[model samples]
Target: MITDLIAGLFMIAGTFLMFLAGLGLLRMPDLLMRMHATTKAGAMGIGLVMIGVALHFLEAGVTARVLIIVLFVMLTAPVAAHTIGRAGYFVGVPLWEGMLKDELKGRYDAETHTLASPPEHQNKEP
Candidate 1:
C-alpha cells in the first residue's frame, strides 16, 4: 500500500521533471546554456522516470532492464551534449552576452593560436 503510493509519487515527480526539461530547452538561450539545461534536466527526468518505472514493475528482469536503461542514459547523454557543444563552438556560435567569464576561451587563447591570429592576440602583434 505505502510502497504503491510512494511509487505513484515518484512517477508524478518524474513526469514534472520531464516537463521542466522541455521548458528549459525551450527557454534557455545560447548553445552552452541550452546544453546545460538539456543535460541536467534530461538526466534527472529520465533517471527518476526509470526509477519510478522500476518500482512499479518490482520484478527481477524488468527492474534489471530498467537499471540497464538508466546506465545507458547516464553514460551517453553527457557525451552527446559535450560533442554537440564542442561542435557548436568550433562552428562559431556566439555566446550569450550575460556570460561573465569563459574558462575555455582563456585556455584556448593561451595555449593555442598565435600573436597574429585574431582578437586578444592581435593587440600583441607588431
Candidate 2:
C-alpha cells in the first residue's frame, strides 16, 4: 500500500515537471532559455518517473532497465543541451536583452571560428 502511494506521488510530481517543461518551451523568450528549461526539467521528470516505475515493479529486470534509462538521460541531457546552446550561439542567435552577463563577449574569433580563453585577470568570478 505504501509503495503504491509513493509511486503515485513520484509519477504525479514527474508529470508536473514535464508539464512545466512544455509550458517553458512555449513561454520562454529565447532559444537558449527554452533549451535550458526543457533539458533540465525533462531529464529530471524522466528520472523521477523511472524511479517510480522501478519501485512499483520491484523486479530485477525492470528495475535494471529503469536505472539504465535514468542514468543515460542524466549523463546525456546536459551535454546535449550544452552542444545545442553552443551551436545556437555560433549561428548568431541573439541572447535575451535582459541577460546580465555575457562571458563569451570578445572571446570568439569570427574569421577563424574559434574561441580564445579568457585572460588571466578575467578568470576570477564576480
Candidate 3:
C-alpha cells in the first residue's frame, strides 16, 4: 500500500539522520565543536527517529509518547550542553584557536574567575 511505503521511507530517512549524527560525534574536534555536533545531531536524530516511529505506528498513545520524548529532548539538550561547557571551561579545557574572540575571557582573569561578572549591574569586588 502507498501508506506503508511512505512509512518505510520515513524510517529510512530517520535512520540515516541518526547515523549521520553518530558520525559527527565521532569526527568533530574540540569540546565546543564536539558540543555543536552532539546537540545538532542529537536533536535531529531523535526528532527524525520519533517522526518515523510515530508515522509507522499511527497510534494515539505511541504518537503521544513520541511527542513527549521529543519535548524532553528539546528541553534538556541545551541545559546539558551548557552544564558540560561550563565544566569544561572551569576545568581549563582550551578552546579552539580559530575563535577570534573569547567573551568569557574578561570575566575570567586566567587563574581566578571574577564573581563580580562583566555585567553592568554586577557589583565589583574591592
The estimated TM-scores of all candidates read: 0.80, 0.93, 0.80
lDDT of 3 by residue, 1-126 (tens): 666677777777767777876787788666877777778777777877787788878899999999999999988998898889878876789987787877677566655644335786555665
Model 3: runs farther than 4 Å from truth?
Answer: 109-116, 119-126
Which model, 2 or 3, shows the larger TM-score? 2
Residue 59 in candidate 3 has what lDDT? Answer: 96
| Clashing residue pairs in candidate 3 (N, C-alpha, C atoms within 3 angstroms) | none
The best candidate by TM-score is 2
Better of 1 and 2 by lDDT: 2
Per-residue lDDT for 87 in model 3?
Answer: 80
The lDDT, on a scale of 0 to 1, for candidate 1 is: 0.81
lDDT of each: 0.81, 0.92, 0.78
RMSD of each candidate relative to the true structure: 6.5, 1.6, 4.6
